[model samples]
Target: MAKTQEFKATERIEAPQGGPGRGAMGGGMVGQKAMEFVPSGKRLAARLRPDRGKAVLVVLLGVVSVALMSVGPRILGHATDIVFNGFIGKQIPPGTPESEWPQAVQGMDVVPGQGVDFDAVAHVLMIVLAIYVGASVLGWLQGFILNTVVQNTVRTLRQDVEDKINRLPLGYFDRSPRGELLSRVTNDIDNVSTTLQQTMSQLLTSVMTVFAVLAMMFWISPLLALVALVTVPMSLLVTAQIMKRSQGQFVAQWRRTGALNAHVEESFSGHALVKVFGRQEEVEAKFAEENDELAKVSFGAQFVSGLIMPSMMFIGNLNYVLVAVIGALRVANGQLSLGEVQAFIQYSRQFTQPLTQIASMVNLLQSGVASAERVFELLDADEEPVDATGAAAPGRRGEVAFEHVSFRYDEDRPLITDLSLVARPGQTVAIVGPTGSGKTTLVNLVMRFYDIDAGRITLDGVDITAMPRAALRSQVGMVLQDTWLFAGTIRDNIAYGRPGATEDEILAAARATFVDRFVHSLPDGYDSLIDEEGSNLSAGERQLITIARAFLTDPALLILDEATSSVDTRTELLLQHAMAALRTDRTSFVIAHRLSTIRDADLILVMEEGAIVEQGTHEELLAASGAYARLYQSQFTAAAVGEEV
Candidate 1:
């Protein structure tokens, strides 16, 4: 009968957006400067250290393949010379050797009266083909090995991230958005995988090809090789300038991506609430703003990085023109053979092609490193204090005592101070107060979700801190106001309380908590599949299932925080009866705002502003005419007025 609170339309929505006390926005990297390339690149490279042997083999195969392919053009050039020599010889005097020919033909290896040697050309072509075929086979083998190494490295990285998430403290999660954390784990890690997969083999091959082709170029003609080398500095200048401009844009692009994902996730999770409050337009407007920001940064990053390829191509063309004119002049002066000139031209093309490939791969490397930095940040976060080694075992008798405990979420604002209480075995202690009265915090301390700042808490005369967290928690059972059920069958959800519970034990717990009343009516009975959100079940039905889960644990201590607040009157009454049966031989802590539910509690403690104000049985507190009497009278008068109306 208490007055129900109405939510105003102007109330601020609790969407997971950027603000103070919520940690950094945009996957915890917003407003921070872009990370330096060298350190991040090195750290990313460290992830590949485990597979270094396979990586070395990949590099060796690439080098061997490039070496074989580099020799093809020079060998093929010999065939060209043979044909040219034979044609000249056929036009000369009969039966005359090349030494007796004119000065222009004297240097050519040709015999008079001989036509083109088709058999010699065929033999050269076959050798070149065989070299190319060997190179191709080696390339394929290296690709296969490189792929395996990359996938294994990524798998190990994913496992590290998963383990890191478990080690972080509850306070870290309270300050971070769920969506942002998920983005770091899923989106960032996936981008890292793709970047490594696409860039590793190609980058290695291109670099090796560049060196191999350069050595061949100099071996053919040093002067022409130097002319081709003129473009190397120019290409590097262009690459450095463009990459410097695009690096920050790439960082912004990924940061905005995380923010956009966070907004969308929060909006979808609370879509019903948003629609009920008529805030769809506001949500859409915010989405549009973030989407526009992401698009703008993406465009800038791509546009700047796109200049590398065209710029490299232009310089390469200039180098090619210089090499061709010089080589033709050298050939006309009889300083080089026509075949050598042709081979040099092919080598020029090969040289510039690898440079172009290297320039293009820079963009992918930058983006990958950016994502790796974000993932490394998650792995470097401060974790919870390590559990005690060889800690003492907890007693099964649930006698909990809090002695002068003091705690605070923030250093400047004190929450619970000098709080002391004791709950003997087989007792029911009810806590009653208004909102922000530290009722939930009390139980949370008992569960050790957040360690206290000072003083000690104990179970069965042993300090809770002296026992391992898992050992201490194993003897306690808790039921929160919000119900959580994974996507699984009803029987599976119930069995989650005890992993190896028998079918008979599960049925017994379900029947004891009245969950069988509705579950039996479903077509699949206990085998019915529940979606992740459990939308298939009603509110009361879900609560009943959670209660049944707690019952199956059969713990010595139980904590129920507003467990009946969301159910209807009939359902609440049924739950109260079931809870009574469950608490027959266990110590139970109940936190409630509806005073009627705690009338029969052995001890009722009234709290105000994080301090205990009064304590006694319900009738005794009412007789004393204190804070408890005021709260009861107001509710009783409101109920009577509603009945009269």
Candidate 2:
């Protein structure tokens, strides 16, 4: 089995000084925030680690860089031991051991005859300068490579999220909050990028540097090293405590941001409607409320994160003072040489370096955890249908059957019930219903937009639920009541239905739907740019363009919903003829109003309150005096009155 990544998931915490998101760890994550999303930490590290050749080169250079850092201190300590301790400008006395250290070590001797090696210090200083140059060059290369890896990985993660969204069932889009989804894709993934590229790499280098310094410090004076060690665990504990506080706040902050984003998206998408209805003030008020909530959460998170730096500074300063004072006392007591004392103090700075970094990285960790939780949540959302996994049933000619189908938007709001219908090749089946009577819902099911709560729909005698969604959808075409023309040339929009279609085919499709008339009227004809949503085109023109798209596809199954309702009588007459021609060689489903459009339909299904109450040819249904009969009667009576007027 492929191993899952194991990133820490943060949720709203309960009961603590501060925990994950909600304030402390005890509050628990709100939903799936508790799930780990990253691959194993070790695995993540391994992938990020420098490859062998690069690792060896960088480490060797890092060694030289660290050694250069050690150089300044050794020179200063020697200068102090010789000048301040009155051992300068002369060779060591004959009794002085060659270990050079003034302190005694068990079974060890320090040649402490060094007075002042000014010439030698000068030589090593040159070497240190060279090492510094080498270190800088290598650091640049290492950083460049690591950043490249991190950026690529982050890019891959973003692509993965996008691809998953695409493969997810259409129902997933209907059910999810657009704001929350956007947050996961943009904000959350960006956090992972920042942390991995910056903090994670720095942490690795800091760990090595800290250990190297401690090893050198212990060699200089084991007792003083022990004193320095005293502060290590304490500093780490303080950092950990602060991190525990800050991480939770950040998690909560991210969640709040997502909620605020959702509010903004909804408000902005509805801005025109709000203005038209004079609800702008109400919308503004709602936006402000959400913004304030985000601010409150953000402040809490950022305040805790900001505090970590100061707390670490305090701990580090205290340790620095203690190390210096104790080192001085030990030197005065003859237990530590001036040189050794100086080296111990230098090492003390190194000890706190990583502790300082740990404090700083806490914020990054918190942000990363929050993002990881969201990413994991999306990746792990349950798929819509378990059986939509196979190839589509093969047939060149179209046939669709709804077998005792039922569906509900929610348990309390059923939009379809016990619906059964069929459409065969070369037949136009018209569905007539009042609003909320499941006209669109029936079409949605045929497209497999939603699976029936209890029934099967089949194409070519095979259950559509068993087919891969993409494969099944490839054979279907639709022209919706609300025609949307994208920003493209007339030819481009028509040809979009079959991207590889020849220009002649596109022009032919446009002519078939009467879109060529409008194209010829435009300055650039078929090459003219259509403004957003085809706003440049008249409603009739846009509808024709959409019908042109559907015609271009030559789909085995076609849907035209209120296609001619928005047009003038002349345009409707044109559309009626075009549709008739389009319907001659394919199976078609149409949702019709304007009564005259469905007069010649081979079959008409009249729906009421989610059930099919009547079905037959136009005259047959009129004869039955059912729901279809009443609808025809209403139209005929209205027409009769208009005639008398």
TM-scores of the candidates in the order shown:
0.91, 0.84
Question: What does candidate 1's lDDT look like per residue over 456-540, in tens digits?
Answer: 9999998888888888888988888888888999999889889899999999999988889999999999999998778999988
Q: Which stretches of candidate 1 lie over 4 Å from their true place?
A: 1-34, 91-113, 623-626, 633-645
Error of 2 at 289 (Å): 1.1
Model 1 earns a TM-score of 0.91
lDDT of 2 by residue, 355-383 (tens): 68867877777678667767766766655
Q: In terms of TM-score, how similar is model 2 to the real structure?
A: 0.84
Shift in Å, residue 570, candidate 2: 3.1
lDDT of 1 at 335: 77
Worst 10 residues of 2 by lDDT: 15-24
- Residue 289 of model 2 has an lDDT of 75
**Highest TM-score model number:** 1
